[model samples]
Target: MDDPVLRFNLRELPVPMVYATHRIIRDCNEEFSELFGYSRSDLVDRSFARLYPKHADFVRTGHMWGAHLPGGKTYYDERIMTASDGHRFWCRVHGRTRHPTDPFAQAIYCFQALTRPVVLGKIRLTDRQRQIATLVAQGKTSAQIAEEIAISVRTVESHRARLMKAARLTNAAELVAWFSTQNSS
Candidate 1:
Protein backbone atom coordinates (compact mmCIF):
# COMPACT_ATOMS: atom_id res chain seq x y z
CA MET A 1 0.00 0.00 0.00
CA ASP A 2 2.98 2.29 0.51
CA ASP A 3 3.96 1.84 -3.10
CA PRO A 4 3.54 4.92 -5.32
CA VAL A 5 1.67 2.79 -7.88
CA LEU A 6 -0.99 1.78 -5.34
CA ARG A 7 -1.29 5.34 -4.13
CA PHE A 8 -1.80 6.55 -7.67
CA ASN A 9 -4.65 4.07 -8.06
CA LEU A 10 -6.54 5.66 -5.13
CA ARG A 11 -8.36 7.78 -7.66
CA GLU A 12 -10.11 4.70 -8.96
CA LEU A 13 -11.36 3.56 -5.58
CA PRO A 14 -15.14 3.79 -5.08
CA VAL A 15 -14.92 5.75 -1.86
CA PRO A 16 -13.88 9.35 -1.55
CA MET A 17 -10.13 9.55 -1.06
CA VAL A 18 -7.42 12.15 -1.18
CA TYR A 19 -3.64 12.14 -1.14
CA ALA A 20 -2.00 15.22 0.29
CA THR A 21 1.46 16.46 1.07
CA HIS A 22 2.05 18.94 3.88
CA ARG A 23 -1.71 19.54 4.21
CA ILE A 24 -1.97 20.51 0.57
CA ILE A 25 -4.07 18.25 -1.60
CA ARG A 26 -1.88 16.55 -4.15
CA ASP A 27 -4.52 14.29 -5.68
CA CYS A 28 -8.06 13.12 -5.15
CA ASN A 29 -10.35 10.65 -6.84
CA GLU A 30 -13.45 11.48 -8.86
CA GLU A 31 -15.67 10.39 -6.00
CA PHE A 32 -13.93 12.81 -3.68
CA SER A 33 -14.32 15.69 -6.07
CA GLU A 34 -17.96 14.83 -6.69
CA LEU A 35 -18.74 14.36 -3.03
CA PHE A 36 -17.27 17.73 -2.10
CA GLY A 37 -18.46 19.49 -5.22
CA TYR A 38 -14.95 20.46 -6.18
CA SER A 39 -13.33 19.72 -9.51
CA ARG A 40 -9.96 18.01 -9.59
CA SER A 41 -8.41 21.25 -10.73
CA ASP A 42 -10.03 23.14 -7.84
CA LEU A 43 -8.59 20.82 -5.25
CA VAL A 44 -5.16 19.94 -6.52
CA ASP A 45 -2.38 21.97 -4.92
CA ARG A 46 -4.94 23.56 -2.59
CA SER A 47 -4.72 23.62 1.19
CA PHE A 48 -6.92 20.99 2.83
CA ALA A 49 -8.29 23.76 5.05
CA ARG A 50 -10.79 24.61 2.33
CA LEU A 51 -12.76 21.44 3.13
CA TYR A 52 -13.44 22.33 6.77
CA PRO A 53 -16.71 24.00 7.76
CA LYS A 54 -14.88 26.53 9.90
CA HIS A 55 -11.41 27.87 10.43
CA ALA A 56 -11.58 26.78 14.06
CA ASP A 57 -12.42 23.21 12.98
CA PHE A 58 -9.42 23.21 10.69
CA VAL A 59 -7.16 24.37 13.50
CA ARG A 60 -8.71 22.06 16.06
CA THR A 61 -8.45 19.02 13.78
CA GLY A 62 -4.82 19.77 13.09
CA HIS A 63 -4.14 20.04 16.81
CA MET A 64 -6.05 16.82 17.50
CA TRP A 65 -4.09 14.78 14.96
CA GLY A 66 -0.67 16.46 14.93
CA ALA A 67 1.07 14.37 17.56
CA HIS A 68 -0.31 10.98 16.54
CA LEU A 69 0.36 11.00 12.81
CA PRO A 70 4.12 11.49 13.00
CA GLY A 71 4.35 8.45 15.27
CA GLY A 72 2.99 6.05 12.61
CA LYS A 73 -0.53 6.11 13.93
CA THR A 74 -3.75 6.12 12.00
CA TYR A 75 -6.16 8.82 13.06
CA TYR A 76 -9.92 8.58 12.76
CA ASP A 77 -12.56 11.13 13.62
CA GLU A 78 -16.03 12.30 12.73
CA ARG A 79 -16.70 15.93 11.95
CA ILE A 80 -18.65 18.29 9.79
CA MET A 81 -17.08 19.23 6.51
CA THR A 82 -18.10 21.83 3.98
CA ALA A 83 -19.06 21.14 0.44
CA SER A 84 -17.94 23.46 -2.28
CA ASP A 85 -21.36 25.06 -2.21
CA GLY A 86 -20.94 25.68 1.55
CA HIS A 87 -23.37 23.08 2.86
CA ARG A 88 -22.12 21.03 5.79
CA PHE A 89 -22.37 17.31 6.38
CA TRP A 90 -21.00 14.85 8.87
CA CYS A 91 -18.24 12.55 7.69
CA ARG A 92 -16.08 9.86 9.20
CA VAL A 93 -12.51 10.52 8.17
CA HIS A 94 -9.77 7.88 8.17
CA GLY A 95 -6.21 9.07 7.69
CA ARG A 96 -2.68 7.67 7.63
CA THR A 97 0.62 9.21 6.78
CA ARG A 98 3.14 7.55 4.51
CA HIS A 99 6.13 9.02 6.27
CA PRO A 100 5.75 8.48 9.99
CA THR A 101 8.84 10.49 10.77
CA ASP A 102 7.44 13.45 8.84
CA PRO A 103 3.78 12.68 8.54
CA PHE A 104 2.80 15.85 6.82
CA ALA A 105 5.17 15.07 3.96
CA GLN A 106 2.72 12.53 2.54
CA ALA A 107 -0.69 11.37 3.69
CA ILE A 108 -3.87 9.65 2.57
CA TYR A 109 -7.37 10.30 3.82
CA CYS A 110 -10.66 8.53 3.20
CA PHE A 111 -14.07 9.97 3.99
CA GLN A 112 -17.32 8.21 4.65
CA ALA A 113 -20.50 10.24 4.89
CA LEU A 114 -22.65 9.35 7.86
CA THR A 115 -26.39 9.24 8.15
CA ARG A 116 -27.55 12.57 9.55
CA PRO A 117 -30.99 11.78 10.95
CA VAL A 118 -29.67 8.93 13.06
CA VAL A 119 -27.12 11.20 14.70
CA LEU A 120 -28.54 14.68 15.14
CA GLY A 121 -32.25 13.92 15.25
CA LYS A 122 -32.41 17.30 13.59
CA ILE A 123 -31.95 18.83 17.03
CA ARG A 124 -30.29 22.18 17.04
CA LEU A 125 -28.32 23.33 20.04
CA THR A 126 -27.96 26.84 21.40
CA ASP A 127 -24.56 28.49 21.11
CA ARG A 128 -23.75 28.03 24.79
CA GLN A 129 -24.85 24.42 24.71
CA ARG A 130 -22.75 23.83 21.64
CA GLN A 131 -19.76 25.36 23.39
CA ILE A 132 -20.30 23.19 26.41
CA ALA A 133 -20.68 20.11 24.23
CA THR A 134 -17.44 20.86 22.41
CA LEU A 135 -15.63 21.28 25.72
CA VAL A 136 -17.03 18.03 27.01
CA ALA A 137 -16.01 16.17 23.88
CA GLN A 138 -12.51 17.53 24.34
CA GLY A 139 -12.53 15.86 27.78
CA LYS A 140 -12.80 18.97 29.87
CA THR A 141 -14.20 18.63 33.34
CA SER A 142 -17.28 20.59 34.38
CA ALA A 143 -15.16 22.68 36.71
CA GLN A 144 -12.66 23.41 33.95
CA ILE A 145 -15.47 24.28 31.55
CA ALA A 146 -17.09 26.51 34.17
CA GLU A 147 -13.88 28.39 34.83
CA GLU A 148 -13.02 28.74 31.17
CA ILE A 149 -16.49 29.84 30.14
CA ALA A 150 -16.83 32.20 33.11
CA ILE A 151 -20.01 30.60 34.32
CA SER A 152 -20.98 29.42 37.76
CA VAL A 153 -20.69 25.72 38.55
CA ARG A 154 -24.38 25.59 39.32
CA THR A 155 -25.20 27.25 36.06
CA VAL A 156 -23.02 24.83 34.16
CA GLU A 157 -24.69 21.94 35.89
CA SER A 158 -28.11 23.29 35.07
CA HIS A 159 -27.22 23.71 31.42
CA ARG A 160 -25.80 20.22 31.32
CA ALA A 161 -28.95 18.83 32.82
CA ARG A 162 -31.01 20.52 30.17
CA LEU A 163 -28.72 19.23 27.43
CA MET A 164 -29.03 15.68 28.72
CA LYS A 165 -32.80 15.92 28.76
CA ALA A 166 -32.83 17.35 25.29
CA ALA A 167 -30.56 14.65 23.98
CA ARG A 168 -32.30 12.00 26.06
CA LEU A 169 -29.02 10.94 27.56
CA THR A 170 -28.76 9.83 31.17
CA ASN A 171 -25.45 11.08 32.54
CA ALA A 172 -22.41 13.24 31.95
CA ALA A 173 -20.43 10.37 30.54
CA GLU A 174 -23.20 9.51 28.10
CA LEU A 175 -23.48 13.14 27.12
CA VAL A 176 -19.75 13.38 26.51
CA ALA A 177 -19.76 10.20 24.45
CA TRP A 178 -22.74 11.41 22.48
CA PHE A 179 -21.12 14.73 21.80
CA SER A 180 -17.84 13.11 20.87
CA THR A 181 -19.48 10.62 18.53
CA GLN A 182 -21.64 13.27 16.96
CA ASN A 183 -18.69 15.55 16.39
CA SER A 184 -16.52 12.69 15.26
CA SER A 185 -18.56 11.46 12.27
Candidate 2:
Protein backbone atom coordinates (compact mmCIF):
# COMPACT_ATOMS: atom_id res chain seq x y z
CA MET A 1 0.00 0.00 0.00
CA ASP A 2 1.39 3.39 -0.97
CA ASP A 3 -0.22 5.01 2.08
CA PRO A 4 0.38 3.27 5.38
CA VAL A 5 -2.96 4.31 6.82
CA LEU A 6 -4.81 3.60 3.59
CA ARG A 7 -8.34 2.58 4.46
CA PHE A 8 -11.15 1.43 2.20
CA ASN A 9 -14.65 2.66 3.12
CA LEU A 10 -13.43 4.02 6.44
CA ARG A 11 -15.76 6.94 5.79
CA GLU A 12 -18.52 4.66 7.10
CA LEU A 13 -17.03 4.92 10.59
CA PRO A 14 -17.52 8.69 10.93
CA VAL A 15 -19.19 10.26 7.91
CA PRO A 16 -22.93 10.43 7.26
CA MET A 17 -22.71 8.20 4.21
CA VAL A 18 -20.52 5.86 2.17
CA TYR A 19 -21.05 4.08 -1.13
CA ALA A 20 -18.99 1.45 -2.93
CA THR A 21 -19.36 0.30 -6.48
CA HIS A 22 -17.61 -1.68 -9.22
CA ARG A 23 -19.36 -2.05 -12.55
CA ILE A 24 -22.73 -3.74 -11.96
CA ILE A 25 -22.08 -4.58 -8.32
CA ARG A 26 -22.73 -1.96 -5.64
CA ASP A 27 -22.89 -1.81 -1.87
CA CYS A 28 -23.82 0.93 0.57
CA ASN A 29 -22.81 1.17 4.17
CA GLU A 30 -25.51 1.68 6.81
CA GLU A 31 -24.73 5.40 6.95
CA PHE A 32 -25.02 5.60 3.20
CA SER A 33 -28.43 3.95 3.27
CA GLU A 34 -29.78 6.37 5.85
CA LEU A 35 -28.33 9.49 4.30
CA PHE A 36 -29.45 8.75 0.76
CA GLY A 37 -32.85 7.38 1.83
CA TYR A 38 -32.18 4.20 -0.10
CA SER A 39 -32.50 0.63 1.12
CA ARG A 40 -29.70 -1.90 0.60
CA SER A 41 -31.86 -3.97 -1.75
CA ASP A 42 -32.74 -0.92 -3.84
CA LEU A 43 -29.17 -0.02 -4.88
CA VAL A 44 -27.72 -3.15 -6.43
CA ASP A 45 -26.79 -3.18 -10.10
CA ARG A 46 -27.44 0.55 -10.39
CA SER A 47 -24.92 2.79 -12.07
CA PHE A 48 -23.08 4.84 -9.45
CA ALA A 49 -23.34 7.94 -11.63
CA ARG A 50 -27.13 7.83 -11.37
CA LEU A 51 -26.55 9.54 -8.05
CA TYR A 52 -25.13 12.49 -9.98
CA PRO A 53 -25.97 13.98 -13.34
CA LYS A 54 -23.89 13.01 -16.40
CA HIS A 55 -21.19 11.18 -14.47
CA ALA A 56 -19.83 9.46 -17.55
CA ASP A 57 -17.58 12.46 -18.11
CA PHE A 58 -15.88 12.08 -14.74
CA VAL A 59 -13.94 9.05 -16.02
CA ARG A 60 -12.51 11.26 -18.76
CA THR A 61 -10.43 13.52 -16.52
CA GLY A 62 -6.63 13.20 -16.48
CA HIS A 63 -6.56 12.46 -12.77
CA MET A 64 -9.14 9.66 -12.95
CA TRP A 65 -7.56 8.31 -16.11
CA GLY A 66 -4.20 8.24 -14.43
CA ALA A 67 -5.54 6.03 -11.66
CA HIS A 68 -6.72 3.39 -14.11
CA LEU A 69 -3.19 2.49 -15.12
CA PRO A 70 -1.95 -0.98 -14.23
CA GLY A 71 -0.56 -1.13 -10.68
CA GLY A 72 -1.11 2.62 -10.52
CA LYS A 73 -2.73 4.55 -7.73
CA THR A 74 -3.65 8.22 -7.31
CA TYR A 75 -5.32 10.54 -4.91
CA TYR A 76 -7.69 13.37 -5.79
CA ASP A 77 -7.18 16.00 -3.11
CA GLU A 78 -10.65 17.45 -3.44
CA ARG A 79 -13.54 16.71 -5.74
CA ILE A 80 -16.95 18.32 -5.54
CA MET A 81 -19.52 15.55 -5.84
CA THR A 82 -23.19 16.39 -6.04
CA ALA A 83 -25.62 14.60 -3.77
CA SER A 84 -29.13 13.44 -4.55
CA ASP A 85 -30.57 16.80 -3.46
CA GLY A 86 -28.10 18.87 -5.54
CA HIS A 87 -25.82 19.64 -2.57
CA ARG A 88 -22.13 19.39 -3.42
CA PHE A 89 -19.51 18.19 -0.95
CA TRP A 90 -15.76 17.97 -1.22
CA CYS A 91 -14.45 14.41 -1.16
CA ARG A 92 -10.85 13.25 -0.91
CA VAL A 93 -10.88 10.30 -3.27
CA HIS A 94 -8.14 7.70 -3.59
CA GLY A 95 -8.26 4.83 -6.06
CA ARG A 96 -6.27 1.91 -7.44
CA THR A 97 -6.68 -0.60 -10.22
CA ARG A 98 -7.32 -4.15 -9.05
CA HIS A 99 -6.69 -7.18 -11.16
CA PRO A 100 -9.65 -9.49 -11.65
CA THR A 101 -9.81 -12.67 -9.59
CA ASP A 102 -10.86 -14.45 -12.75
CA PRO A 103 -7.81 -14.85 -14.96
CA PHE A 104 -9.57 -13.96 -18.20
CA ALA A 105 -11.12 -10.66 -17.09
CA GLN A 106 -9.64 -7.16 -17.00
CA ALA A 107 -8.88 -5.04 -13.90
CA ILE A 108 -11.40 -3.52 -11.52
CA TYR A 109 -11.65 -0.11 -9.90
CA CYS A 110 -11.42 0.35 -6.14
CA PHE A 111 -11.79 3.74 -4.48
CA GLN A 112 -12.41 5.34 -1.12
CA ALA A 113 -12.99 8.80 0.37
CA LEU A 114 -11.60 10.68 3.34
CA THR A 115 -14.07 12.43 5.64
CA ARG A 116 -11.85 15.35 6.59
CA PRO A 117 -10.85 18.71 5.22
CA VAL A 118 -7.56 18.69 3.30
CA VAL A 119 -6.28 21.90 4.91
CA LEU A 120 -6.74 22.50 8.64
CA GLY A 121 -4.95 25.78 9.24
CA LYS A 122 -6.04 29.33 8.52
CA ILE A 123 -4.41 30.54 5.30
CA ARG A 124 -1.88 33.35 5.93
CA LEU A 125 -1.74 34.95 2.47
CA THR A 126 -3.83 38.11 2.17
CA ASP A 127 -5.50 39.39 -0.97
CA ARG A 128 -2.77 41.98 -1.44
CA GLN A 129 -0.08 39.32 -1.08
CA ARG A 130 -1.83 37.18 -3.69
CA GLN A 131 -2.04 40.18 -6.00
CA ILE A 132 1.67 40.77 -5.51
CA ALA A 133 2.29 37.11 -6.27
CA THR A 134 0.30 37.38 -9.48
CA LEU A 135 2.35 40.38 -10.46
CA VAL A 136 5.49 38.43 -9.69
CA ALA A 137 4.20 35.55 -11.80
CA GLN A 138 3.82 38.05 -14.60
CA GLY A 139 7.63 38.39 -14.46
CA LYS A 140 7.85 41.68 -12.52
CA THR A 141 10.94 42.36 -10.41
CA SER A 142 10.89 44.12 -7.04
CA ALA A 143 12.07 47.50 -8.35
CA GLN A 144 9.85 47.16 -11.40
CA ILE A 145 6.92 46.11 -9.22
CA ALA A 146 7.59 49.02 -6.84
CA GLU A 147 7.61 51.43 -9.77
CA GLU A 148 4.27 50.10 -11.01
CA ILE A 149 2.72 50.19 -7.52
CA ALA A 150 4.31 53.57 -6.68
CA ILE A 151 5.89 52.08 -3.55
CA SER A 152 9.46 52.35 -2.34
CA VAL A 153 11.91 49.70 -3.43
CA ARG A 154 12.43 48.82 0.24
CA THR A 155 8.70 48.39 0.81
CA VAL A 156 8.43 46.13 -2.22
CA GLU A 157 11.38 44.19 -0.91
CA SER A 158 9.70 43.94 2.48
CA HIS A 159 6.52 42.66 0.87
CA ARG A 160 8.57 40.14 -1.07
CA ALA A 161 10.28 39.05 2.14
CA ARG A 162 6.97 38.63 3.95
CA LEU A 163 5.40 36.91 0.96
CA MET A 164 8.20 34.37 0.84
CA LYS A 165 7.82 33.68 4.54
CA ALA A 166 4.06 33.28 4.28
CA ALA A 167 4.29 31.13 1.17
CA ARG A 168 7.33 29.20 2.46
CA LEU A 169 9.71 29.79 -0.43
CA THR A 170 13.53 29.99 -0.23
CA ASN A 171 14.36 32.74 -2.76
CA ALA A 172 12.66 35.93 -3.92
CA ALA A 173 12.98 35.21 -7.66
CA GLU A 174 11.63 31.65 -7.29
CA LEU A 175 8.89 32.92 -4.98
CA VAL A 176 7.86 35.57 -7.46
CA ALA A 177 7.17 32.95 -10.14
CA TRP A 178 5.76 30.41 -7.66
CA PHE A 179 3.53 32.95 -5.99
CA SER A 180 2.19 33.87 -9.39
CA THR A 181 0.79 30.38 -10.05
CA GLN A 182 0.15 29.42 -6.41
CA ASN A 183 -2.09 32.41 -5.88
CA SER A 184 -3.68 32.43 -9.31
CA SER A 185 -7.32 31.42 -9.12
Candidate 3:
Protein backbone atom coordinates (compact mmCIF):
# COMPACT_ATOMS: atom_id res chain seq x y z
CA MET A 1 0.00 0.00 0.00
CA ASP A 2 1.18 3.53 -0.76
CA ASP A 3 2.27 5.37 2.37
CA PRO A 4 -0.45 7.97 2.96
CA VAL A 5 2.00 10.40 4.56
CA LEU A 6 4.45 10.08 1.67
CA ARG A 7 1.70 10.69 -0.86
CA PHE A 8 0.61 13.87 0.93
CA ASN A 9 4.21 15.00 1.19
CA LEU A 10 4.79 14.33 -2.52
CA ARG A 11 2.00 16.72 -3.46
CA GLU A 12 4.58 19.35 -2.47
CA LEU A 13 1.80 21.67 -1.50
CA PRO A 14 3.11 25.13 -0.75
CA VAL A 15 1.35 25.23 2.58
CA PRO A 16 3.14 24.47 5.81
CA MET A 17 1.13 21.30 5.84
CA VAL A 18 -2.10 19.80 4.66
CA TYR A 19 -4.84 19.54 7.23
CA ALA A 20 -6.70 16.39 6.26
CA THR A 21 -9.93 17.36 7.95
CA HIS A 22 -11.31 19.65 10.68
CA ARG A 23 -8.80 21.21 13.02
CA ILE A 24 -9.56 18.92 15.94
CA ILE A 25 -9.77 15.75 13.95
CA ARG A 26 -7.01 15.95 11.34
CA ASP A 27 -3.29 15.42 10.80
CA CYS A 28 -0.53 17.88 9.98
CA ASN A 29 2.46 16.95 7.88
CA GLU A 30 6.11 17.16 8.98
CA GLU A 31 6.68 20.61 7.48
CA PHE A 32 3.91 21.87 9.67
CA SER A 33 5.68 20.38 12.67
CA GLU A 34 8.94 22.09 11.71
CA LEU A 35 7.38 25.47 11.07
CA PHE A 36 5.11 25.60 14.12
CA GLY A 37 7.52 24.00 16.63
CA TYR A 38 4.98 21.31 17.31
CA SER A 39 5.22 17.61 16.52
CA ARG A 40 2.69 16.10 14.19
CA SER A 41 1.50 14.02 17.11
CA ASP A 42 1.05 17.16 19.22
CA LEU A 43 -1.09 18.90 16.61
CA VAL A 44 -2.97 15.94 15.23
CA ASP A 45 -5.81 15.96 17.73
CA ARG A 46 -5.77 19.61 18.72
CA SER A 47 -7.91 22.39 17.32
CA PHE A 48 -6.26 25.17 15.30
CA ALA A 49 -7.96 27.32 17.91
CA ARG A 50 -5.16 26.22 20.23
CA LEU A 51 -2.69 28.20 18.18
CA TYR A 52 -4.60 31.47 18.44
CA PRO A 53 -4.83 33.98 21.22
CA LYS A 54 -7.45 33.19 23.80
CA HIS A 55 -9.60 36.15 22.72
CA ALA A 56 -9.51 35.32 19.01
CA ASP A 57 -13.09 34.24 18.45
CA PHE A 58 -13.19 35.76 14.99
CA VAL A 59 -10.77 33.06 13.78
CA ARG A 60 -13.11 30.24 14.72
CA THR A 61 -16.06 32.07 13.29
CA GLY A 62 -14.27 32.68 10.00
CA HIS A 63 -13.17 29.08 9.73
CA MET A 64 -16.72 27.87 10.29
CA TRP A 65 -18.60 30.41 8.21
CA GLY A 66 -16.13 31.49 5.53
CA ALA A 67 -14.74 28.05 4.67
CA HIS A 68 -17.74 27.13 2.55
CA LEU A 69 -18.07 30.33 0.55
CA PRO A 70 -17.07 30.27 -3.12
CA GLY A 71 -13.63 31.77 -3.93
CA GLY A 72 -12.90 31.90 -0.23
CA LYS A 73 -9.95 29.52 -0.23
CA THR A 74 -7.67 32.00 1.41
CA TYR A 75 -7.48 31.03 5.05
CA TYR A 76 -6.24 34.18 6.76
CA ASP A 77 -3.78 37.00 6.32
CA GLU A 78 -1.81 38.94 8.90
CA ARG A 79 -3.10 36.87 11.77
CA ILE A 80 -1.27 37.22 15.07
CA MET A 81 -0.15 34.01 16.72
CA THR A 82 1.53 33.72 20.11
CA ALA A 83 4.26 31.12 20.26
CA SER A 84 5.04 28.68 23.04
CA ASP A 85 7.94 30.96 24.01
CA GLY A 86 5.52 33.89 24.51
CA HIS A 87 6.63 35.73 21.39
CA ARG A 88 4.12 36.83 18.78
CA PHE A 89 4.21 36.68 14.99
CA TRP A 90 2.01 37.70 12.10
CA CYS A 91 1.19 35.06 9.50
CA ARG A 92 -0.74 34.46 6.30
CA VAL A 93 -2.31 31.05 5.61
CA HIS A 94 -3.69 29.83 2.29
CA GLY A 95 -5.83 26.72 2.01
CA ARG A 96 -6.71 24.48 -0.98
CA THR A 97 -9.41 21.86 -1.31
CA ARG A 98 -8.64 18.13 -1.63
CA HIS A 99 -10.46 15.35 -3.45
CA PRO A 100 -13.85 14.07 -2.15
CA THR A 101 -12.67 10.46 -1.53
CA ASP A 102 -9.76 11.68 0.57
CA PRO A 103 -10.89 10.66 4.06
CA PHE A 104 -13.02 13.78 4.49
CA ALA A 105 -10.04 15.94 3.54
CA GLN A 106 -11.07 19.42 2.45
CA ALA A 107 -8.18 21.86 2.41
CA ILE A 108 -4.43 22.21 2.08
CA TYR A 109 -3.24 25.02 4.32
CA CYS A 110 0.12 26.62 3.59
CA PHE A 111 1.73 28.75 6.22
CA GLN A 112 3.91 31.77 5.72
CA ALA A 113 5.94 32.97 8.70
CA LEU A 114 5.58 36.69 9.29
CA THR A 115 6.89 37.05 12.81
CA ARG A 116 9.99 39.02 12.00
CA PRO A 117 10.23 42.45 13.60
CA VAL A 118 11.08 45.24 11.23
CA VAL A 119 12.50 48.42 12.71
CA LEU A 120 12.70 51.62 10.76
CA GLY A 121 15.24 53.96 12.34
CA LYS A 122 14.61 56.94 10.13
CA ILE A 123 13.39 60.22 11.72
CA ARG A 124 12.61 59.13 15.23
CA LEU A 125 10.78 61.67 17.44
CA THR A 126 11.38 62.32 21.11
CA ASP A 127 8.52 62.62 23.59
CA ARG A 128 9.12 66.33 24.27
CA GLN A 129 9.12 67.09 20.57
CA ARG A 130 5.87 65.17 20.17
CA GLN A 131 4.23 67.14 22.97
CA ILE A 132 5.31 70.45 21.52
CA ALA A 133 4.10 69.38 18.09
CA THR A 134 0.71 68.56 19.58
CA LEU A 135 0.54 72.02 21.11
CA VAL A 136 1.53 73.58 17.79
CA ALA A 137 -1.18 71.54 16.07
CA GLN A 138 -3.74 72.98 18.49
CA GLY A 139 -2.80 76.49 17.31
CA LYS A 140 -1.18 77.44 20.62
CA THR A 141 1.58 80.03 20.55
CA SER A 142 4.87 79.10 22.24
CA ALA A 143 4.17 81.62 25.01
CA GLN A 144 0.68 80.24 25.56
CA ILE A 145 1.86 76.64 25.56
CA ALA A 146 4.71 77.48 27.94
CA GLU A 147 2.22 79.00 30.35
CA GLU A 148 -0.25 76.15 29.98
CA ILE A 149 2.39 73.49 30.46
CA ALA A 150 4.24 75.41 33.23
CA ILE A 151 7.43 75.65 31.16
CA SER A 152 9.41 78.79 30.43
CA VAL A 153 8.66 80.62 27.20
CA ARG A 154 12.30 80.32 26.27
CA THR A 155 12.13 76.55 26.81
CA VAL A 156 9.09 76.28 24.57
CA GLU A 157 10.92 78.35 21.97
CA SER A 158 13.90 76.00 22.17
CA HIS A 159 11.62 73.05 21.71
CA ARG A 160 10.10 74.68 18.66
CA ALA A 161 13.53 75.43 17.19
CA ARG A 162 14.64 71.82 17.57
CA LEU A 163 11.35 70.57 16.17
CA MET A 164 11.68 72.81 13.14
CA LYS A 165 15.21 71.53 12.50
CA ALA A 166 14.23 67.91 12.99
CA ALA A 167 11.10 68.16 10.90
CA ARG A 168 12.66 70.47 8.25
CA LEU A 169 9.80 72.97 8.29
CA THR A 170 10.58 76.53 7.17
CA ASN A 171 8.04 78.47 9.19
CA ALA A 172 5.35 78.37 11.86
CA ALA A 173 2.61 77.99 9.21
CA GLU A 174 4.31 74.93 7.71
CA LEU A 175 4.95 73.57 11.16
CA VAL A 176 1.34 74.04 12.10
CA ALA A 177 0.08 72.49 8.89
CA TRP A 178 2.46 69.56 9.19
CA PHE A 179 1.51 68.96 12.79
CA SER A 180 -2.16 69.31 11.90
CA THR A 181 -2.03 66.56 9.30
CA GLN A 182 0.09 64.34 11.54
CA ASN A 183 -2.52 64.61 14.26
CA SER A 184 -5.54 64.22 11.97
CA SER A 185 -5.84 60.48 12.30
lDDT of 2: 0.48
- Residue-pair clashes per prediction, in order, are 3, 0, 3
TM-score result, candidate 1: 0.67
Model 3, 1-185: lDDT tens digits are 88666453523555566564544527666667666677777777676766664533335334432434234334333344555554555456666555433322555566788634423324454545645665676677999768655689999999889878877989888986665433211
Global Cα lDDT for candidate 1: 0.78
Question: How far out, in Å, is residue 119 in model 1?
Answer: 9.9
TM-score of each: 0.67, 0.38, 0.46
lDDT of 1 by residue, 18-52 (tens): 99898899999999999899899999999989998
In candidate 2, stretches whose alpha carbon ends up further than 4 angstroms from where it belongs are 1-22, 34-37, 61-63, 66-69, 72-74, 100-185
Best of the two (1, 3) by lDDT: 1
lDDT of 2 by residue, 1-185 (tens): 58678576633464443333343325555555444455656655565565432353243332233433335333232243445665443344443444433211222332334343323223455544644554575567878767655678898778778878766779867774454233121
Model 3, position 9: C-alpha lDDT score? 54
In the predicted model 2, the residue pairs found to clash are: none
Residue 164 in model 3: lDDT: 84
- Candidate that would win on lDDT: 1
Better of 2 and 3 by lDDT: 3
